[model samples]
Target chain A: MSSNPQLRRAVTPWGSFSWGYSDVGADIFIGLGLVLAYAAGASNFAFLFAGLVYVCIGLAYTELAAAYPVAGGGQYFVLRGLGDLFGFIAGWAVLLDFTIDITLFAWSSVDYMSQLLPAVLASVHPWSHFLVVLGLIGLLCLLNVIGVRESTAFQGSVAAVDVLSETLILCFGFLFAFQPQILIHTMHVSWPSMFGLMQGTSLAIVSFVGLESISQAAQETQRPASVIPRTSVVLILTILIYAVGYSNLALGMQMWHPVHDAHGHAIAFWQLFPGNGDNQGKAVALLSAQIPYYGLLAQFYVPILGAILLLISANSGVFGSSRIAYSMSTSKLLPSVFQRIHARFRTPAASILTFCGLAVVVLIFAALPQLDHGARAVYQRLFHGEDGITFLGDLYAFGAATSYSFVFVALVALRLFDPMTPRKFKIPFNIPMRVRGERVEFPIIAVIGFIGIFSILVFTLITHDIGRVAGPGWLILGVFLYFLYRRNKKLPLFRSQPHDWRTAQTSILKNAGELELMDEYHANLRASDERKRALR
Target chain B: MIRLRTGFYFLYVALGTIILVRVLSFGVRFETITGIVLGILLIALGIYRLFQVTRVRTSKR
Candidate 1:
């Protein structure tokens, strides 16, 4: 094996799986709340729907990551399969989700804490809630600036504990409280309209959004081709089961303790839960408290566990957004200011500051009342619980669905255009096609994935009331910046470099032990370059 | 390797058939157009995989 200093792949398969596993911690805490807010009695169907889509996307990501392992997640995959323009769009969308991830996690962390102490709940007066969220973000930014990486042992321990605790809670909860007849009755009574179901499905996609961290760890893992497929498949299945099971269990509990209306009448939990935002943000902890034997366990255990996991997730988002911005700058898609490092801490201080600023702006936007009553009315009509956290959720769903759709498209295109790239695992049920005498396989999985993801993207536009506007607003800004950067660099606005594709292919092949193919490709590339120089 | 490839082809066919039967039995409601489209796509893919199996057998001969 050729020993390059930067090519040290040390992570095992378990390690690779753990990388993605840790990132999924706080998704349960936040996602259940948002889905219940929209789908109410049909939250299980929403999760099941989104989980199927997640399965398809996960397989697509596995195929792409195995073929072209890299660190930039979906952004890098789309960049290579599609060109720079689509690449920029995908990356920009991911950046939006990351910013929201930070804001939402910080706000939810405080929400969980508020369940423990009434003083924290009372902090929502005036600017106090906003100040607390900002303070949390600031603290995380400071810690990142000081270069505090979570120890691998810490990540592993938290992931294990969280998984075990959640499983026990679900198992015991269902054994005690689950009734088939009650679930059926709830589903019949609270069956959502098609539009509402689609909206809930879109929000449910946010629960599995951060699993791309698995694909992003491709280059760092030993034997990525073999490891990625196993890890990603398992990861997708685990998250799917958890999301669907928890949503269904929560619905059963809601049936037992139906929320009462003002006239002392029983009503759906979603209607009253979102009223004044009491239970809107902290839905999961409240659900845990309703579990039969485990009700007492939740009072002491759930709040602290939730707070810790959410804080970690928020910390990850702060650092992740800055890193992605720095990468975009390095690739000349953004201004050089983002690439500036702090002299003292050697961190991307400017990028961190910029993303934190964007998060602050988003928080303020959601906090402030919309000047246009028309806009607020439309938002309320489409979605329940119109608050800062839900607004953040709308953007998160939009960003996640949009970028993931691009990944699906990229996976299909690559399978068609770049076959023979060693894939230890491909999405099952591919059809062979001879495209211009090249043996290419068509990815049926990616096609289904694209259909699912694109539908969600459309639903986000129609259902997310606020997201439809804000998501496009962010994309427009990105396009403008992309063009400005290109003009300043004297590069063509949409031209792709042939060298990049060849280099990415060669690097992936070399790692897969297809060194002979790598050498032949390099030799041909060199000969072609020499011929061009000779012609010149 | 040949048996493995053939098995995979058969596997695809089985999966496609199952999806089609399940979806068609579920009733073709206006809201379930998405499911119908998916079933059709899977069937097409399955037939194509069968063709791939034939290709592999022919090459061996």
Candidate 2:
């Protein structure tokens, strides 16, 4: 083994953006259908509300990632700003999201591919579908354990094509098929009930999932502080546009293919895609396939494209989970076993295997409702008929909401305490203040983001019966393990271990090859020290 | 490749302008406002990309 181990800084600016894009951008493929089903005419509104909160969260992440440039992402920030306990909780919650990302996207990828191969459809051939998802997960795990450079190049190219294709679909969709009158009419007539709107908004947050990929990939990114802000802001806006644009277009567009309701009545295009078992998972492909003349070609390629994108997203989960586990283990939050890197491959093989195994476990649990008649009956009776992709979505929303709530608080806390870290990107609308003889900027947007994300967490608990039980159960299990591990190591359970953050920051900056940032950080420390001496 | 990339940015600028004009021509209301925001964002993004390209070229020179 090498004496000193480190993640190579090879991810360029575009690679960094594509890393985040391939993960988060794939969400709309699944999210659009779920939001449409629940939020109905108010799907646009749900997306709008969630998109706004996402912008806030994105801004906070950009600021923090640029400052820290670490692999643990929200977990690392929370550990620095809050204490070890809260950081562990955040990390644990993020781990749940990452694991679910693997299963959810893998399952949905198969669903999209099933558009081309109807026999493997999850709704029809449950076992075959389950096996396919398992196979994909295994393949992704092997690919990650071997190396990431090749996969990153593949991810970037796929992301570029998908982006171009989506833009073209939207342009053609709006130009030929979209009607403002239809959208307004739908909103007026088919606006969802209060509970439905709440549920839809909660699910809409799924479209903004995988923002953590930005910060997660930061450890391997070249000049992260400079690149992250530009890429992240664009990513945020691009996603927001796609989410709102697609929802509006779906509601307003004239149907290219004739759709029928349950009673054999003809219905709008939006009415056909949602609630339909076959269409829900491959909604983006269906949406693209309805775009005027483009539909002719899109019908063939969009499904293939969607499947590839979703698989890439699933691969991102494998990459993210292992890296986060590695980071956590390095900080002594997890067992040292998780920190083991393969001597030849130089990858976190243990973390990849363990988390990927957990993903398999999650996939099995999600598949329980689909596996047998008795299990299906029990799940339906107990969890309000939520299973399959919906089950995965519920857990995903819960994990993301839980971790994001902590991240906002961490952003605020970091702003207050660690003013010495030179933040290249600061969340706008800050109220500068002096607290306990320290200069601090009270981030107003972070508070708003906290309220928004916390409400979504409450919404997830209130609306998702399965998620309400399973999500907290996951956290409780994690906390128990944390206590046992800490006790075994003779470490403080509640209190944070003493850490010299200045020295750590210097090392991090030096390793990242950011001498200029290190100098600026030193200057800030010197200035702060002088001020303290003057005060004394 | 650089020219193609610049062309894509130009397309973005045009697309954003078209969307903005089309939405505004329909008259501003609750339903159309989101489109307005999206159009504005797209335009800004295109401008930013173009600016970045110019800056890079100038730095190289």
lDDT of 1 at A497: 40
Q: Pairing residues by index, what is the TM-score of model 2?
A: 0.97
Q: Write the per-residue lDDT of candidate 1 for residues A1-536, one digit (tens) a residue.
A: 11112323545676666667766657878888888877877777777778789889888888787766665678877877787888889989989988998888888887887888757553345266667778888887777676523333455667667766676566555557655445556677887888878878888888887766666557556667667887786677566656765776666544445557789998744454533454767777777776777777876788877777777777667656766666566566678776676665556777777888888888777665433456556556765437777788899999999999999888877777666455667788989887644567888888888898898899889987679888999999999989998988887798864446676678676775556556666775676567658767
DockQ of each: 0.04, 0.54
RMSD of 1: 8.9
Q: Which CAPRI tier for candidate 1?
A: incorrect
Candidate 2 Cα deviation (angstroms), residue B20: 3.2
Q: Which portions of model 1 miss their true places by more than 4 Å?
A: A1-15, A146-152, A219-223, A254-261, A265-276, A336-349, A370-385, A507-536, B1-61
* TM-score versus the correct structure, for each prediction: 0.79, 0.97
Per-residue lDDT for A1-536 in model 2, tens only?
44246777778888899889999999999999888988999888899889999999999999999999988999999999998999999999999999999999999999999988886564688889989999999999999998778888999999999989988898898888888788878888888899999999999999999879999999899888889999998899889988988998888888887678688887887786555656778899888888899999999999999999999999999999998898888888999887787877778888899989999999998898788889889988999778688889999999999999999999888898999899888888989899768888999999999999999999999998988999999999999999999999999999998888999899887877778999999999999999999999
* Candidate 2 structure lDDT: 0.89
In terms of DockQ, the best-performing candidate is: 2
